[model samples]
Target: MSLTDSEILLLEQLIHDREVDKLFSRLTTITEETNPNYKLLFEAINSQKWGFNDKNRPVV
Candidate 1:
């Protein structure tokens, strides 16, 4: 199956948002000098998400 232009754009936006969410979460922890949110911490990062597991589910 093929995605239309808008679907592709939305997919790109979702990926970007997920990455930004985790980055912001990480930054907040760093600024506070505290432990990370383990749930977010354990989820495969952007680089690893594709191959990590349960490939059907979206990364965020």
Candidate 2:
């Protein structure tokens, strides 16, 4: 299958968002308190409803 230019851009943005989510997760893990920034990032990561395969059945 082929992706259009807009689809490709969306895919790129999703990948970048996932990377940022990973970074936030790691930072949150290392930090002691669940500060506002960490809470916001955690919520943003959890709020994402896409990026998972059939077997995963959860946020990616």
What TM-score fits each model?
A: 0.48, 0.48
* lDDT, residue 44, model 1: 35
**Per-residue CA lDDT of candidate 1, range 1-60, in tens?**
999999999999999999999988875454444545654654435337343346666543
Q: Each candidate: how many clashes?
A: 0, 0
lDDT of 2 by residue, 1-60 (tens): 999999999999999999999987777673556587767887898788776677876554
lDDT of 1 at 31: 44
- Alpha-carbon deviation at 51 in model 2, angstroms: 36
Work out how many backbone clashes candidate 1 has: 0
Model 1, position 60, has a per-residue lDDT of: 31
**Clashes in model 1: which pairs?**
none
As a whole number from 0 to 100, the lDDT of residue 9 in candidate 1 is: 98
